[model samples]
Target: MALPKAHRLKSRHDFQAVFREGIRRHSSHFTLRALKPAVATEPSLDTASPTANYASTKIGISISTKVSKRAVVRNLIKRRITAAFYQLLPKLAPGWRLVVIVKPTAAESKCGSQQFLQELEQLLAQAEVLNGHS
Candidate 1:
């Protein structure tokens, strides 16, 4: 379950209402964008096939078996990511569903927690989420 809304992005429909749609680069940072027609309407709403757009992004995290294998570790990653989101949402514009995929290093290393957070901070910064922190 998600933590109580720092401010709910609510549903994908709600996300569509404001989707600043961005993508994770090869570098793993998100790029910010304005709403496009593709970003605004659900495939069902759009009368089109459900082909995910690449130029845009959804914050989806992957905590793989390689990363944790343990349910508890995966849950920890989720909590960490959500906490980061709560702290950053004020600065994030609307219409994004963040999916944070956890790396193996995220759970196996002693310093993984700090590294995970730093990587998150980097991604959020690249996405411009902190540009308007308030």
Candidate 2:
């Protein structure tokens, strides 16, 4: 299954912000970019709750043509990566932006979802984005 809309990063600006300001964590097949939410400049309307606008963690997956010329292969990789994230969602911290980039070697290696999950968990922990990491 795919991620929920609220938990998926859909904008080009959001992805670019993460890529520009996020910290990078790497594994053999993937690179994870993670950024904490930016503080709001304007005052929130709800005076009673300062974090009313706080959001859950949002993620984006990017699979380049360099990973595979065929769309099928790239999509398969994306699915595996998404599944991995879906399983880990409950354990992740909130209000973070993340992007997962698939490296070319992943397609060549033909890794499975379990491998993706393990590597992803490792990367998240390394980036200190996992819950309880702080």
Predictions in order: lDDT? 0.51, 0.91
Error of 1 at 17 (Å): 15
Q: Which stretches of candidate 2 lie over 4 Å from their true place?
A: 39-49
For model 1, the stretches where C-alpha displacement exceeds 4 angstroms are: 5-22, 26-60, 112-115, 132-134
lDDT against true structure, model 2: 0.91
Instruction: Find the candidate with the highest TM-score and give its number.
Output: 2
* Model 2 clash tally, residue pairs: 0
**Predicted model with the maximum lDDT:** 2
Q: How many backbone clashes does candidate 1 have?
A: 12
lDDT for each residue of candidate 1 in 1-101, tens digit (9 for 90 to 100): 45455344346564444433445432232222323224535345644644444322334444567776689877877677766655555465444455454
TM-score of decoy 1: 0.53
lDDT of 1 at 61: 45
lDDT of 2 by residue, 1-134 (tens): 99999899999999999999999998899999999877778876768867644679999999889999999999999999899999999999889999999999999996799999999999999998899863
Q: Candidate 1, after superposition: displacement of residue 121 in Å?
A: 2.0
